[model samples]
Target: MISANKLAGASSSDKYRQIHDAFEKTGRHWLYNATVGAGLPVNHTVRDLIDSGDTILALSGIFSGTLSWLFLQFDGTVPFTDLVDQAWQQGLTEPDPRVDLSGKDVMRKLVILAREAGYDIEPDQGARGVAGAGALRRRVRRSLL
Candidate 1:
């Protein structure tokens, strides 16, 4: 399934799930690499690394161009929500701005990465609570340092 849309994850409501499911199940090999790129096709790289017996600790990158630009424009001078509103007004966000605000795209890509990394992580299971999120933020920040 050559899909650029954010519908490849395990969403039963998603019509294209069958195509992506096939690619995930039987190594159909025709899957289109979309999202979660780190200068290259990161999903394919993760799959390749897994196939070659490499362990994937974490997959990280700026998946959404709009989100990346929004972060760049944020310097705390204006409320972050105000920046999001501005971006939405400028048509830089999805038709439903909540999708971007909720990290919908990024969460879906995270699930895909988890599956490729050989973890049976479902979309719902990918959601970490506030406390877990704080620890994850700390870990990522320390890694950068």
Candidate 2:
């Protein structure tokens, strides 16, 4: 019969457990980007960028499509409505996409990123949503056109 500790050790080898361990060890976070076809590696992590004093751009959007889809939208090949529909179909958006569109999700992400960068930002302190009725879409369309 396997001992409890042995079983625990065996189970800890699971991929998610390993990832959790890495995160604990390094105090870093990882995000999987389907457009890149892989998780951001350790060297390219947010912590590394912040530590190195490099500028980091984080885009927080409700569209569940891959990062490549986002780029296409930027180029005006994809419509904002279509992106929202796709994200809903993919179960990535709340039943009310407004919650995301209102920039709450983006604010949360920004707060986390700021905290990791050594900023003591309260969740309610620094988040301002730029979301408005068709504003983002109109801006993108205008810029690309």
Candidate 3:
């Protein structure tokens, strides 16, 4: 079975308890692909690493379409607030831009990546901080959404 719920291992065990038990009892395999990078094969790569007995200490990347465009459109000349507004107007930001600025979605993806690397941890359980995400988040909160 293949599943791509983008749950990011968030309450995943409980969420998939029945499915997991079914697979365990039936000796069937379950392919749960946590998609955080659109259709990128990051989870697959991590799974392969684990299957090959390799250790992964870290994983990082831009995992949000909204943020990706925002980052690319940003320059030192323009205020982040203006850029955020532009992003919103251009439909490059989330419905609530603050959601993207907060990095929760990205954090969820990170949690999934870590899970793929064999870490049983929650989003809050792990340390999370994006260098400039806070500034952007503040700008988004105060100026836009």
TM per candidate comes to 0.65, 0.40, 0.64
Name the candidate that leads on lDDT: 3
Clashing pairs in 2: none
TM-score for model 2?
A: 0.40
Ranked by lDDT from best down, the candidates are 3, 1, 2
What lDDT tens digits, residue by residue, belong to model 2 across residues 29-90?
54432211123332235567788887655534332223334445544466777887787678
lDDT tens readout by residue for model 3, 22-123? 889999976666356666777788889999999998776667888888778776568878989998998866677897888776776777778778887666
Alpha-carbon lDDT, every model: 0.70, 0.49, 0.73
Task: Give the TM-score (vs. native) of candidate 3.
Answer: 0.64
Which ranges in model 3 have alpha carbons more than 4 Å from their true place?
1-4, 12-34, 76-96, 128-145
Flag regions of model 1 displaced more than 4 Å: 10-29, 76-82, 85-92, 129-145
The weakest ten consecutive residues by lDDT in model 3 span 7-16
What tens-digit string does per-residue lDDT give for candidate 1 at 16-126? 456656677987665546655533687788889999999988766676666887989987578778998899899877778777767786777777777778887657766
Model 3 alpha-carbon miss at residue 91, Å: 6.1
Clashes of each: 0, 0, 0
